[model samples]
Target: MATIAPSPPAALIDGFGRRISYLRLSVTDRCDLRCRYCMGEAMTFLPRSAVLTLEEMAAIADAFVARGVRRIRLTGGEPLVRRGIGELAARIGRHLATGALDELTLTTNATRLAEHAPALAAAGVRRINVSLDSLDPERFRAITRTGDLGQVLAGIAAARAVGMAVKINMVALKGVNEDEVGAMLRWCVAEGHDLTFIETMPLGVVDEDRTDRYLPLDGVRRDLIERFGLVADAHRTGGPARYLRVPGTATRVGFITPLTENFCDGCNRVRLTASGRLYMCLGHDDRVDLRAAWREGGRDALDAAIDEALALKPRAHGFRIEERDAAPAVARHMSATGG
Candidate 1:
């Protein structure tokens, strides 16, 4: 009898011994809102034909799952803006039910959640991350350029009504909506939603200087500690944010300090752009054109391309805004790469 050989491990481990189990997949680069920090006012959106179809997305996701990626978060300029998103969610959900994927989540601006929340929840999206910078109506409009605060609030309610776990992501910016941090926290606590404060990064072209908008969360974290008696919580959802619980309340606030405090050491995720490019790091521009491989050589060729990209994953991202004038700037925009 011939001896049988063991199969290879089904996980993508980088050079730093980190097992990458999460994938942020961008379904579309088009967005409804034009946030200043995310993109420029006059931007050219990608042609519809350039984007990967829903089937293509599922195929790429399946390949990653075969290689040990169990969790996936659909993101975009705003994922909800993409057509046939409900069907896409259902397709990914089938993978979840089959045990090929563990979780399927989405990060949206919540502009269209009111219309699609029920379908999304029924389709297997159990969790959602909504981006809301300010609760104030005028301030919200100013921040998002064309957003209605009431619409987003209603969308949030719709998402919750559908039994989806909702988390609010606020990109805290100095002189922008930073003053509303305390108010936002209180509102989230009242609504029974967890909140996360994110420091703005220099990923894409913004309306102002990147340094001007950068707001470190150190001060905000200190404020939470002193005012709300905030304490670190021993809860992690396999994401980068650090969770802190408010005493006497079930509400938890998180801080994602990509700038003031780098969490690249614990990085265990990779990104897939809507255009079929695999990004090794968000802060860096290292990418592999998987679409080319798929069209040229099919699944085997794409698997080889993915393996090559995984091997080239950088140990850490060299992100520094202060040194922007000295070093080469990141040319890719956040919209194109997906946040």
Candidate 2:
């Protein structure tokens, strides 16, 4: 039997006394589909040589688990699209068997979930988050530029067949898919899957104006209350989505409002890039390069780099959408940081 390594004495606690328990480690920045909101139509992906090896990624996950990270989520431009992703997930999922990690989950576009669901389930992943902005086929194609709604729907079905709990993440866009929020909620309820609406964030330079598509969740919630009679739900899923449930229904609907409210007080997560750069806050540009540290002096050096990063963790990410032509707070795209 392979022996599990003992965690270090001190835990990863930020300057604001917020314990870092969750880590979103990105495997690859390369993705198949180019969503209009996420990136430009013509794009250049990071060179393969710039990305960290699967062995390095697994080792970093182990290091985080040792430093009190309870939840490890493998995020990406699309995690399932990466080669040998199942092996990487299984390597980190071993911590679940030892009780060192509480959850080993992932967020995917679901276009590739059909081929990976069985391997992921076998790797000890019980839950997954799927990014599905629209239920309509034509709208989906337009939004994603190269995605097939039928393929995504089939992937979702494949995930459900493996007894995996699925949550559909929909980005509520004004003049885009706002009219379908009500119908989307109904579909989620009928399909026995939870649905979450996320306000579009200003991440990178896209073809369209961010203001044009920014849809506030406050209006969406008011609509829900009137239509479905939503009851406030205290369902905490470790992420920043405040939940609500329709009266007498099992489905829990979530709203992630980053624009209308301050959702950073309870922030306990950090994003790690595929290149091993640890970003303490998504909206801020502060980061620590762990690849060089790990390659230099191994785990001890990597842990020290993590400690240095905790000191730089901001109290709150001051995310504000500037003027129509102004630059975003953080210049890098969401895909580069890990969606």
Candidate 3:
């Protein structure tokens, strides 16, 4: 007979007095689409062995739930690329059903959601976020290097059919898809999906010096009010995005400006890379490797490492133009980091 340790309570408030009830975990770095901003033409990827095993990921999530993390979102370069992901979601859902967790979600490019969303929803996932760069097929292909607009749209339809709360994340690139802001909002409204307009992060290939293609959230919202007569203000979501809405439509818009307005003060989530490294912030390279310690020290050692990483988190990320020189330290690009 085997004995299982008792799980921890389901709630714990962090130092910031924010209830730390949610966690986002990346299962693999493998992705089908290579967006220009996240991954360039040619980039090396981590070896298979370097990536954490499914069991390891579950154990980590279980530990997280034991520590009051009631909500978990499985992220990836494209999480659907990972084999048997539905099975992983099923296991997590089992824990959630047992009162250990309350919510389970997934974020993806929606290329595979049409085929996978039903099973994913059946396995306990209740929400999803799809990344759609642009509505123009040619522009989308150019930006993502692989445009399957029809398939992506079908995927969204499939997920919606399954009663999942759908949100679309569109990164507003200055010269690229900035022109589609209002159009994107209208499209999402027509489709009955929520829209989040993310200001390009100064991470990876996009930075302050690369201003030609960088679209600031403020400028976009200003233009929206002046030109299109749309109005935006903060919403009640306790996450990073400040929500907005079209003046006439039933659509809700959002601005996620990590560069212009640092949300670190309200940051409550932690990121675990595919290779089992914990990053305190998406802007910097500060991380603690739990993979190495896991094999030698077991679960207790891993918990201590996570605690130490959290303790080392800085009050805020004061990133500026000068900091571009050290951008490489911020883990891998968003694709590899499973952002």
Candidate 4:
């Protein structure tokens, strides 16, 4: 095993008192589907030139890695929608190969993953997280305007075949696909996929009524346990999810209850929009633009923008209804900011 080196101290705080270590970068703001909750009527496309050039992104990433940001996850409306994404993956992987980056991964919708999974794996991406809300064809189409369940399934299989550590992500919306939760879990368990059931957040183009379907994760888990006899706290060691194992199976079910069980205090993430703005939190509005600084202000200016964003990181989201009311515009849409 490679010996892990100690992380050096870094002094940067966003307005919220959280140290920024993980940077989630968006390569494009465009997507193939208009997922009901994420992209509504249409998307306001960012200009081509506005998105960072590969070199520019690598520069910002380099600076962040230098300042203790060791985890990088490339995200987007759907990162694979962007042309030459695999090339970018290779570039980022090569940058990280220098021993600065501790983890590098991608979060994609997986519609185009089957075509790119092999390339991504060859580029050194050992981890992939695919957003797959439903296994039912009709329900999948209903959730994402034009996604093909067959294609998504193929993509997941392709990634696993390529030897990538795969994680299947699902967003649990109450009345819509809540009934199918058991089926999805059963499928994942049989397939040996690390499944995460995330609670629907009140961001993006979510319909107000969708909140009614926002099954608080606790009740969902309770029902599953009552039905399946879940053995609590049986999650794998060092696992991010708090999971429960089925009564007589090796498979485990995991939950990401952002609403009921907020993981904000341990949040080590920062987001970079497709247009190069750095967000300290999903609950923050204004962001520091590193791309603009790289163009006009140079390297020093770029570093300053990172420092500014990090110094403003919130200690905790303090996510409550009142907080949401106060920061009504704080929540950035999931697709554009990367869900």
Using lDDT, give the best candidate's number: 2
User: Scored by Cα lDDT, where does model 2 land?
Assistant: 0.91
Give the alpha carbon lDDT tens digit for every residue of 217-269 in model 2. 89899989899999999999888999999888789999998888879999999
TM-score for all models, in order of appearance:
0.95, 0.97, 0.89, 0.88
Ranking by lDDT: 2, 1, 3, 4
Which tens-of-lDDT digit does each residue in 1-339 have in candidate 4? 999997653545556555666788888888888777676656677889788887787777777777877678888889998888888888778756788777778988899999999999887888788888888899899899898999988888899999987778888887888888888878877887767788766665444444456678898899888887888766542223688877666666788876787777667678888888887777667578888888998877877777777777765554443232232234457766765
- Tens-place lDDT per residue, model 3, 1-339, is 899998754354544555566677888877888787667666677899899988888887887788877778899888998988988898888886798787898989999999999999999888898999899888888887876888898999999999998989999887788889888877887888888888655555532234555677888878766765666565644458877677777667777888777777787777788899877667767788888768779888877776777666666765553343445435358765656
The candidate that wins on TM-score is 2
Ranked by TM-score from best down, the candidates are 2, 1, 3, 4
| Model 3 score (lDDT) | 0.77
Ten contiguous residues minimizing lDDT sum, candidate 4: 320-329
Candidate 3's TM-score:
0.89
Better structure of 2 and 4 per lDDT: 2
- Model 4 spans with C-alpha error above 4 angstroms: 1-19, 206-208, 232-241, 246-250, 318-331
Looking at model 3, the pairs that clash are 244-253
Off by over 4 Å in 1: 1-10, 323-329
- Over all chains combined, what TM-score does candidate 2 have? 0.97
Model 1, residue 70: C-alpha shift (Å)? 1.2
Better of 1 and 4 by lDDT: 1
